[model samples]
Target: MQPDDVRRTDVSTSPPDVKRPTRRRALVAAAVAAAVLLPAGAAVGYAYTGEVPRGVTVLGVDLGGLDRAAAGEALRAELARRSADLAAPVTVRVEDRTARVDPSAVGLAVDVDATVAAAADARPGVFARLFGSPTVDPVVAVDQGRLDAALRAAVGDVGQPVVAPAITYDGTTPRPVYPESGRVLDPATAAGALRAGWPDAREVTVPLLDVHPATTTADVDRLLAELARPAVSGPVTVTTDRGDLPVPPAAIAKSLVFAADDSGRIEPRVDEKALRSALGTGLREVEVAPKDATVVLDGGKPKVVPGTDGQRLDTAALGRDLLAVLPRTADRRVAGTLTAARPAMTDEQAAALGIRERVSTFTTNFTGGLSAPRSNNIVTIARDVDGTIVQPGETFSLNGHTGERSYAQGYKDAPVIMDGKLVPGVGGGTSQFTTTLFNATYYAGLEDVEHKPHSYWFSRYPPVIESTIFYPNLDFKFRNDTPYGVLIDTSWTSDSITVSIWSTKIYDSVKTEWGPRRNITKPRVVHLEPGPSCIATNGIDGFTQDAWRIFRKDGKELKREKFSWRYDAEPRFVCGG
Candidate 1:
């Protein structure tokens, strides 16, 4: 082998005698050169070219700059200049109201400049550094963008402000604002507004009320006119018994007034006028009435009086008697009663009973007889005509038994006291009748339940046994003490009065047990001489006695007690002709 051949072999074996390009080596060489060249080129572009990425937008404003950072800074400055005036408070008007708010309070901010600076300071990795600059800043959008949008929307809708006018309570008339309380609304502005906005489902009405002067008759007339009648939608008239009178629905409504003022409250003013007109037009009316009592003889059998144009009522006489009784009639009803139903009596029967002889009687004035309070008349006749029966444990009331007496009944005036003076009045002597009956009842062993004393002492009657009565307040009462029923019979004569009892005989006989008249306190007596013009009178001493009687049945001891009798101690006046 020659030297050349040997050398070639050595070179082939000696790991590449001549240089060969490799994949890794080529890549490194190219990258180093590009790195050096790209920087230089970028430097040149930045110095001369104003080119920027196509999509580069800052704050929604498109721009061209040396790089993303520079563009961002420029955008921030522009935004700051545009929004500088919005940092302060802004005023908005709505109706009559005004409101002010700081723009910053509504999510507005001046931090854009600082945010841009931070973005400019951020750098990418080494590879991206070699290529191109990173995006200027992560798309900086307004913070709380949605919130700001909402605030802006609200501000856009703000309207003009409103001013309320002042109110006053004038003195025209102090009246309730809500006259119809039920349908009335609150007078407050807010409440009124709400109510006006939505009326109630039901029918509503408001009544107007005001006060007026009531001093003049004219005022009263006006009030009456106002109260005339109410215009009622329903039936218009009603009837009453005082003859046919008219009624209007409106009038009924007028009867009740709303809250009255100084003058008076008038209700349903319109309705009242309408009702009055309707009433004046003459509606048919039915007569309202009361029960009419008819007097009858013997179970309602009436006998007609012969004359007087069928006007059965004795008006003239009744009026005078009523006038006399009126004063005492206060709080009391005028009443009388027949003892019982009576069968008609023929003349023969009346004679047999001696009624004519028994009833013809009169009493003298107080000078010669009992005083006014102790006088009696009606009860006596009642007992005599028809006996009264009182049962065991029964109380007899004079007023309860008697009924009202008017011109319709058979009542005639006797005599009575008027203003403390004697006058002709009906039922004047009735108490005398009651007194006689009372004495008979006492003798019959009945209990004296209630009795009133005379205002003045009377010397002509039995001091211990006499009784008197007025209508309701003053009454004579007694109870039947006996086990059986007792009947009373009374009779009268020109000179004397008698009362008898008819009943089952409770005892064989009743006798008074007399006490000795001892320790007599003699009273002074006087006598006067007779004169031509005046009659002379002698006075006697008064006397009092205590006595008792025993009741026996078949000789058996039944009851025993004391009885008393008293005469006025002053004396009795005896007159002589």
Candidate 2:
């Protein structure tokens, strides 16, 4: 072969001088540039993309490759289809009763916006953009209030109210009523289960919760066993400083009270008011009232009687002690303290009452038949009116001082003037005492507040200067107008009654002037049936008279007072006619 032919064959056989390293370097640089450029391009595309990544699903509905608005529309369309499934009423079973509930009425709704957002969030990363995204569940919202309301309405008619335990006492025995349990739907739990299974399952079982009563039968039983039985087991004896009072078991039982405390426990106690009432009458015997000092006439001179201190049981403290001891087994005893009560008027105060000398004296005579009853009545009145002190600025009432002269007060029936006629009545001779007291007050220059005259004129009493008094209806009142206190002293004999006023003399002298009788009225005779109650007396003519009282100091007239009296005619009554 020739040299050129050999050279060509060598060149073909020597791999033609190929640059493999350079080719490999160029391929590697091209691959690196493609990795960076592709990722950067994808990032820019993702930043500007308005569509959701691929393979995203909401409630099993595909929402991929769609814009936000388009995704929301797709989710809403899928939810609307699912809502058709929810249109079928779900059957709710509670215990033995069953109710059909509409999901829409209970505020069951789909959140399309949230579902779309969840789908968007499930988008694949840039590297994973070539792959599928993860499956996501849509967010569902429910109105809890509306759901609970619908559930309550479904079970309202079938539910029973819970009964609370109670205890009632019937005199000697205590009865207890047991509590009853009630069933109600648990709104939260039942709603969660219902919402999770809604638009899919045709029926759902509602969870039932138990309602417990505040009190139970065990509580009542515990009260009866621990408190009531022990309280009524035996009698309680309450002993004070004076004596012991035995209260029977029945009474103690009535006083026992079983009440609930703040911790819901029944506690035993004694009824305070009932126990106090039971001991009221017994406590009265242990009480002593205070007596004020009195002013009395001793040998025609004012003397002070010393006041006395009183003692009374401390009922409140005794009640507390009794409550403490009453719960014991038997023979319970309690002692009460005696509190001292001071008298209103002390001996020194009584001595300071200015009653030094006799200011005035007056006497009235009764010349008629002085029967034993009439004499007894007069003596009784004099005894009552004697030793009564009239303080300064105080008014003395004859009727108030001398109470009603009934047979209960040891007064005998005698002749008394009534309806212009003398009739048989109790306290017949009291009018004479009134007249004497009035005249004594008049002569003493004391002020007279109120007084009434006799119905007819009488020769025994002064014409217009006398006064008469009956029971509560007619009263003789006089005010002590002096700066010093005045005391009344009364005495009576068989024929006359005397009333004297004792005080510091304020006036020098007192004189009275009388006017002649005028407007005379004749008496009329009347016949009456004879009986034991009939009374026969002489009648008198009626007239009007005027009198004046003149008070003098140091022989000079201080003041002059005028008084007028009008009398009615008294007709004579003839018995056995």
Candidate 3:
């Protein structure tokens, strides 16, 4: 126990303490080795088992230590439960309205197999597995087309469309209807947000965007102030060589067309057709037509008359200039461009017409008891057709010259032959003028283009050779076939009308040959008149006749023209039977 004895004992005890620590170290090493080996053995066993590691979870569903098949079953069940929960309708707010949509209806689904596989893959390495497996969310699958359609349908219910600006015209002014802004839910963005956070969030707000109108109030105001109002403010005066054509404000307003341009700007345009129509009679009055030279017989010789040059207003150029000046407040007058027009026949052409002394003349005598109105009508028709000139190759229409013989042209009711009966009608005596004119043209060797014989053969007219005319429907037409200008000269007294053709003679002589009437039929007995308007008259027998016109030069037969007519029988009428 003293210093030497205490030192020897402490040495022995220290050696014992060192040996004890070595044994303790050996025990600690063995414990650490066992800890590593157990987990390694468990990992090896797990690898051989073909099963998911313990504590693995997918979307909060545990599938610990399960084989692939069992894991898949568990995953399917969990996915079904989760999907059903997510199938709850989520409320979507668009503007002030709300709509509910089931996430599954929009093709939202949980990819259970993929999610399970991902969770299985998240299992840590052998060392980390000793701690725990990771928890992973389920993979979500979405059908974009279905989701887009659903979102659009929902948006359509709540969206307010934008109103476009429009223009309306009053009698004198133009007014603008203003545009309005609108709100619409953005379908694509709203669908994306819903897909990302749906089910978890019970409510979602739809993204809204403003829709602006293409045309605004300012645009309408600009159009009215700059284009529409100025176009119709004042008259546009077009000064031509003839006279001034003042287009009134109302006419300009009617001609002005307002339309939108490619850039969507409203502008004014002049409608050429409308402007021409508005000009109408005014334009025709200002038009100066070229006058052709005429030929006349001067003492049995041909005489040439000179033609006059014509000045015509260029209407197209005037329209353009008028449009240019329409926007101006002052100096609104524009001079129209004049175009020169040459006549078809000149003085040389007139001399070449070959007009000379009278070629043929015919006179028709009417009964002296003809009413004053009938005599006046015959004289009036003769006067109207007196100075008519037919150029070579030109056809003359008697109805075209005389027009409709009615009260408007001072014609009076007179006796006329109509429908195989004599009746009192307007322009009754003009047929006498037609018969005289046809005979003169026939003897003059003119070509007959169109002519109609009277329905009933009249003794007063040449048998089967005379022509009759009605207003516009029926006409007596003949062509001036000779290379000459033929002048129609008409003269009439109280009971006789004469028509003479003055032109260069092409034939030596012309003669008419009449045949006896054949196939005659007896007239029918007349019935009583229906009213006082009916006139009693004696009937005539119906018959057929043939006639011919023979033209000869130097006594040799040149040509012979034959004509035939079949007249219907007339019935006798008793007025007071």
TM-score: which candidate is best? 3
Per-residue alpha-carbon lDDT of candidate 2 for residues 370-449, written as tens digits (9 for 90 to 100):
56787778778888889888888899998888778788876888888776667788888788788899999999999989
Query: What's each prediction's TM-score?
Result: 0.31, 0.54, 0.56
lDDT of 2: 0.76
Per-residue lDDT, model 2, residue 458, is 79
For each candidate, the alpha-carbon lDDT, in order, equals 0.42, 0.76, 0.76
How accurate locally is residue 498 in candidate 1, as Cα lDDT from 0 to 100?
60
Model 2 residue 426 CA deviation in Å: 1.6
Residues 1-577 of candidate 1 have per-residue lDDT tens digits of 6999999998888665334546668899999999999977765554333344323344444443435567656766666676645455444332333334344554434355554554445444444444444554323222244323433354443222221111111221112222221111112321222222211111212122222222333433443333221122222222223233333333434322233342333332223343334354342232112222211123322222221111122222322332233223132222211122223433333223211112112222222132232233443336434545455678988766765322244445554434332345556665565666666666666677886544323554454456666566678888877665554555544444566665445556665566655434544543333443222223334456665656677889788766565544443222332
Per-residue lDDT for 255-370 in model 3, tens only?
67655443334455667777778777777656778998876555555567788998777766776777678777778898977788789888887777676688999998887544
lDDT of 3 at 148: 59
CA error at residue 332 for candidate 2, angstroms: 3.7
